[model samples]
Target: MRRLRNDLPYTFRPARPKDWFRPPALWLNRHWLLERKYRVTAIEEQGFERVRELDATGDSMLLAPNHADHADPHLMMEIGRRYELPFHFMAAREVFEVSKRASWALQSMGVFSVDRDGPDVSAIKMALSILAAGKPLVLYPEGEIYHHHERLDPLHEGVASIGMKACGRVSEGRQVWLVPVGMRFLHDPSVEATFRDRLTRLEDRIGWTPKPKMDLDERILRLGQGVLGLKESEFQVNVAAGGIQDRLESLCGQLLEMVEARMGSDGAAGTAPERVRAMRYRIRRRLLDVDHPPGEDERTLLLDDLDRVFAALQAHSYIGDYLLAEPTLDRRAETIMKLEEDLLGFPLYPSARTARILAGEPISISEMLQRGELPRKGGASALTSLLEERLSRLIEVPAGAACSTELVSRQSGETG
Candidate 1:
């Protein structure tokens, strides 16, 4: 067993393969694990043969999939089996800590641990080695699962950076390609009944009574108002009189400004998402900076500041009930799921839903480099846009479908 050293980041270690690789076990487990747990009815694959064709050419490929649900990685596992391709996935370190058995199984399935809160060279080196060996690497650029289906969040540059950097080290004629994979989990129709029941239970649990005549949107608005009122009281900010969206925006702005002031930042420009992201980056850097560790009081203060910032960020996602605007079956189900998750602090994984995995035409790193499309400045942003565009095109939503307008958190945003 590999051990984390004192010199390394907490839980950091070189990626290690398990004692065995059991393809049949993994394939069987995928069928039972995802279906039984998440109730995924069927996984429809589009253009999967193209990926097989690319693999046949012996060129390295990277799988960059948008993460909207926790079941995404499991879906990818099943896809790997169907395509007859084994790929390595970079999972957050917390997953491995769930249990020794889970860690072993994950490692055997070509999963490596990533410390996303800070830079970890060990994980990057492992990724490069996987690409150099002509193996496919599955890296979700979104970093975290957003649970907001139909909406594509902003992409992180890490996926492009790792793939491009590895491609640069390839021998003369070989090429590396980044495949944009989009996974869309359609909501189960029965979610409406379940949603009403769950929301009723939540209201009861909180000892809050709703009007008998309230509609779905009205109830959502009421819940939002109650939650926002509590937060405003906690923060000692005066309740601003406005529409739900306006009030939410104002309150969140105030909360964030509090953190920024404490951190010595003005945040004069940029959208709320951008400001929250910068604050998080600064907080994480300070918290994880090994060169100069904070003293006891300083550490306590920093932790408290981070807690407040995260709370404010969480509040930002619930603004305006983006799911209620369209009121389509899909939107209703998504909104219901989001509300349940917000109340329950986890995913519901609604039942009998079809998941579509569409692989877009692979983006060629060599071709992009040759065309001078990549720049030292903003290269990752350009690449992120290209991948997001490709994946977004693959997702088909109804003409009037709309989702929450919450700004995608930079640290946790997922591409389409």
Candidate 2:
């Protein structure tokens, strides 16, 4: 019932079988070939009968799936092409804003943008009309790609809203297929680490040095080349599992457990930025989920988290190197304290909607502890002694530097 007005004219077209041999169509098809060569095993098309039926009978439908990877759209495109159907995808503007070249390529491949932050009633109405008019729509129920598979957040009510609105009025015979796609990549998906250097090359190609203030998402994507690892095979074979989020969650759990084992090993404790990056490669594999939330088109929350986690890991690497080279133990401890304070003060969750925004600068820990960082214990005496034991050997620390024997006094003071 909602209308797109003049903003998006061809957005919601009536049922017409797409012949993809035309200009943008052919180019779009060619664009995904590299993906096919590197990442697809077999692009399977299910419900040929349904596709053919929709084409012949003008039934509008939406293809919905859990968002897992950046390549989710391409996977659908490859499958849609094999079936000879064109399904327009709904994505956030952020995905396309990398540049005109990238945005145009996505649009040409039958992908379109919906304003994620600002409300676009017209675009929503336009999308509804497309489904009502007997065309196909592709949407990622999770709304974003995660580096690793994790539990699905609750499904969004939007897809259902569109379906209910179009029932028979826009759709016929109540025939809509909720095609569940379970794509498993047979490669290491370091997504961030695998692609960091390549992304630097990309920046060089563009002849632009990124401002430190560039959008976090843009910086993450630029380095997202290694976000997923290289293909284990020239042809990626994906086996479709059952379509529910829980089933996918169970499968993801198994994969994550394996990832965790490799990440927490002693071998990865201290190293350079590259070594730390490799450590993150394994850690992210465990911490992040591969399965996307249901009914969302692409959630950036996880990617944002990945960026922070990786950045922290990188900082740790640098600090580790610094500590190893520092001449004195007191200075090293001060540096460590400084880093901790910086992170603690950064917005852990700045926005109301986003639960992980950094809030402010971190407190200096000596100040932090003095300000009662710990609830009950006044800095454990034995623990402090043990730490200072090794640290004393490294530097000419003052005689009373490790003295926390006044814990009894400190605790009483804190209580008051």
What TM-score does candidate 1 reach?
Answer: 0.83
Return the clash pairs for model 1, or none: none
lDDT (10s digit) by residue, model 2, range 1-416: 00111111122212223345334554344344323323332222223444545456665656655553344566566555445666777776555655777666666555667653234465577677666666778765444443222223233445544444444354325343333333323232232232334334445544547444554334533322221111111112232254222222333333333333434533523322233334434433433345733223223433333343333332222222232344232322223223222333211111111001001111122323335642224333322232223222312222323212111224324321
lDDT of 1 by residue, 89-173 (tens): 9998867876888787788778899876556688999999898888888999877666666667667778988878887777778
Q: How accurate is candidate 2 locally (lDDT)?
A: 0.39
Predicted structure 1: clash tally: 0
Tell me the lDDT of model 2 at 2. 8
TM-score of each: 0.83, 0.40
- Candidate 2 stretches with Cα past 4 Å from truth are 1-38, 44-51, 149-151, 171-177, 188-416
